[model samples]
Target: MPTIRPSGPADAAVLADIWRASVRATHDFLSEAHFTEIEALVADQYLPQAPLWVIEVDGSPAGFMGLSGAHVDALFIDPRRRAQGLGRSMIAHAARLEGKLTVDVNEQNPQAVGFYERMGFRQTGRSPQDDAGRPYPLLHMRQE
Candidate 1:
């Protein structure tokens, strides 16, 4: 079973690791160079500003999610733990905090889209590019 808890400074590195591992596994359309760039930004930039939660399995950090207002800013699970309900657990926890939740999923990543859809998020809109102006398209989803 997995447990969720508020994240602190000490969990930053673990969260970054999980983010990198998860992205590498599922974001096949992204280049290696992009991963390196994202890793740096997430570790030194994003994580410090977001209110994140860490998900642990057997006392080890397996994943994390960052919430900003009513939106899920980020969610990543260790590649090794994919499909084992860790991501679902993280989303469920986030929904508890923000009853109606929203998230932007990479359009290139069908698995993420499917997961969010299965979790009751409906496509509300889309963006031609990601927030960073990358070529990656984003599917805006909402669950109410």
Candidate 2:
């Protein structure tokens, strides 16, 4: 059985490892440089602000997710665990939150764009680069 629960400070390192592995799993499609930066950013900046959840399958951490307001900050399932509905379960959990849920995916990540759409999120708008000048195409969506 798989269980979903809140992440604590103790889980940070494991969450970082998951983030790294998830990025590497999609390396064929994403820019290597971008993935490198993202891994470090997740370890340093994003993880602290977002609320994380650890997915344990039979008492072992199989994946993790991070939620921030209406946006899904991070959601990753080990490559070996893909297609088992963990991602769907995590997204569904986020959708059940108090407000609209959104996620900003790179325009280049078509798989994610389609996945979010399949999850019932609609394209609402776009956004410019942040203070760091990193161009992140925004996907504003909400659960129906």
Best by TM-score: 1
Measured against the true structure, the TM-scores of the candidates, in listed sequence, are 0.94, 0.81
Q: What is the model-wide C-alpha lDDT for candidate 2? A: 0.73
Q: Against the hidden true structure, what lDDT does model 1 obtain?
A: 0.89
Model 1, 1-144: lDDT tens per residue? 789998888888888888878887889999778778888899998887677889899999998888987899888889898889988888888888878899999999999999999999999999999999988999999985
**Of the candidates shown, which would achieve the greatest lDDT relative to the real structure?**
1
What does candidate 2's lDDT look like per residue over 66-136, in tens digits?
77677786778887787788888888777777465777665556666777888878877666653356665
Report how far residue 142 has shifted in candidate 2, in Å. 2.5
Flag regions of model 1 displaced more than 4 Å: none
